[model samples]
Target: MEHEESNRSEFLVFPLSQVRKEGYKVTRKAPPSATDWSRRATRTQRGILDGSLGHYKGKAVPKGGCSAFAAQTLMKGTKPHRIRIEGMSITHDASATPDGIIDTVLSVMRYSTAVKSDSDERVKGVKGKWSSCMRKAGFQYASPQAAANDSRWSKGNVPTRLETSVAVADMQCKKKVRYLDTLVDVQSEYERNAIAEQSATLASLQSDAKVWLSNAKDEVNKQPATKRD
Candidate 1:
């Protein structure tokens, strides 16, 4: 039990950003604006003025409420469409444990690797595309690695050891469950102590009885001659 506790204390710390980088990237391209030339001209002007129309910039643009045109198209004369700001979506590998007691550690490592690889690929692809777009837009693009090395990204590693410790503890708990029935059926400490005391008392009584019988036989032998006379 002590050894198990010690093992639990040793955990693997992994960076979360590393895991996210290995996961997939969601590319969201808004539907092309309606084919009306007038609308297109207005959109182009808006994009240029608002920094949305040009080649993609390396920096993310803040998306405020949807445009009135988009709301009107969707609502079609209803109260001005309530514009909602959609949240950014992030992708990552699913967490799963491998079967078999001996395989648990290895399984965790494998899962971590799979997640990291997938995330890395996606991040790389996105960085590549972003870099190209930024270049076209006449903006300098920073490498994903550089961004990841920043304080925020540097802080993303997962606590791999902690995860391992949790797994080990869970496994230990499960093993304990298997023995629960037997443990429940076993005699209580008080009952066992009582039984031991009774056995000792019985043994002492048997010894005393033997001693008393031997003495009685000796007394009878000593009186035998007198009784004959």
Candidate 2:
């Protein structure tokens, strides 16, 4: 009995005779190894590599991603370098140092100061014009709210208003204090002159008094000669 040939038949498969033939060789790429993955990561961190990449915090997948695909999907929604300060938009780059962050904050502060200066100048001009107009009309310009709350505007209640005024007064006081500090640098010169002038005047008066007392003593010693006779 002839056994039926196995369902699988061996065909006469031959390698292409010429190495230069397009189908002569079929090469399969190997899956990335651990070293390959590490090199890829280094390149990415250095911003040399293109396309999406994964980042992990620890042993498990990161909160955002498990692979390049997941990481790319998450980062697509991310906004980079958006910052704000005191209701104003500020531009900043990603920072790796605390000092860089501080610089960004200072930049925002400088911008705010510039804006405040411009506003104050405009307000000053407007207030000056309003004051002049009110003066010419012989009418005082006062806040109706202040008039309604007499206690809030009264001189007798000044101490109670300290809390409200302290902020502005404190700023003025700080400027004065700085001016005083500058004056203190020259204080020694003034003090030296004062001490020298005072001491010289006092010494001259003492010398004159001593001379007068000596003359008086001599006169007293010579007196009463006629009286003795």
Candidate 3:
């Protein structure tokens, strides 16, 4: 390898495939196993997926999911946040030219493939309510997403009359029926509960993370300075 990394520097900056052969092997960890971390992380992530079952799914309480809705909607149409961590360090997320570009392109393509999933199915229950609401307003669609992407309404340069009507109706339903608010509530609540339940495991995961960092430092620092370049 042209370069090697070490835990002394708080990073694992070399190519991943050569890590064990040339880098420190992270063999020590706290009580929780790696499998536990993976399982808990997956459970936590599920609440954030864009589906009906995600979010806290809070019951209607007059303001149903107002906090969750605000959390999501307040940032719409804005430039992305540019916050940097003060102490946290990562070697894997560097925005180096071709790698960064390839990573971004792959991310977008992966999202596009979700077109293979039926939006109505992913957000089924809430979508049913939304469709019913729209039907009452003389619009027919399985989900707002489907209405927005309807091939029948894409003939013009801008929105066609039918497209505009469906979009307006969809928005109205989103607002009037508390569909989005409720869904967000459920998703957020689920995440909160999952985090609370996995408290001990999560703490152990942090210790495991440090072990990884230490191993990387050990591996790279042990190598000669000439080999690092």
Best by lDDT: 3
**Candidate 2 residues 1-229, lDDT tens each?**
1112211111111122211121111111144574655555664443322223344333333333333333233223223354455576544322212234345555555455444533454434433444344344443433212222334333442234332332223222223333222223333344444445446433443454455456556656776766563
Estimate the TM-score of every prediction.
Answer: 0.16, 0.18, 0.35
Residues 98-180 of candidate 3: C-alpha lDDT, one tens digit per residue? 22323443343333333322233334666688889999999778766566557765454444556555555655576565555
Which pairs of residues collide in model 2?
none
Whose TM-score is higher: candidate 2's or candidate 3's? 3
In candidate 3, residue 87 scores what lDDT? 27
List CA RMSD, all candidates.
Answer: 38.7, 45.8, 25.9
lDDT at 155, model 2: 44
- Give lDDT per model, in order: 0.34, 0.35, 0.44
Query: Native-vs-model 1 lDDT?
Result: 0.34
- Candidate numbers, best TM-score first, in rank order: 3, 2, 1
Which model, 2 or 3, shows the larger lDDT?
3
Error of 1 at 193 (Å): 58
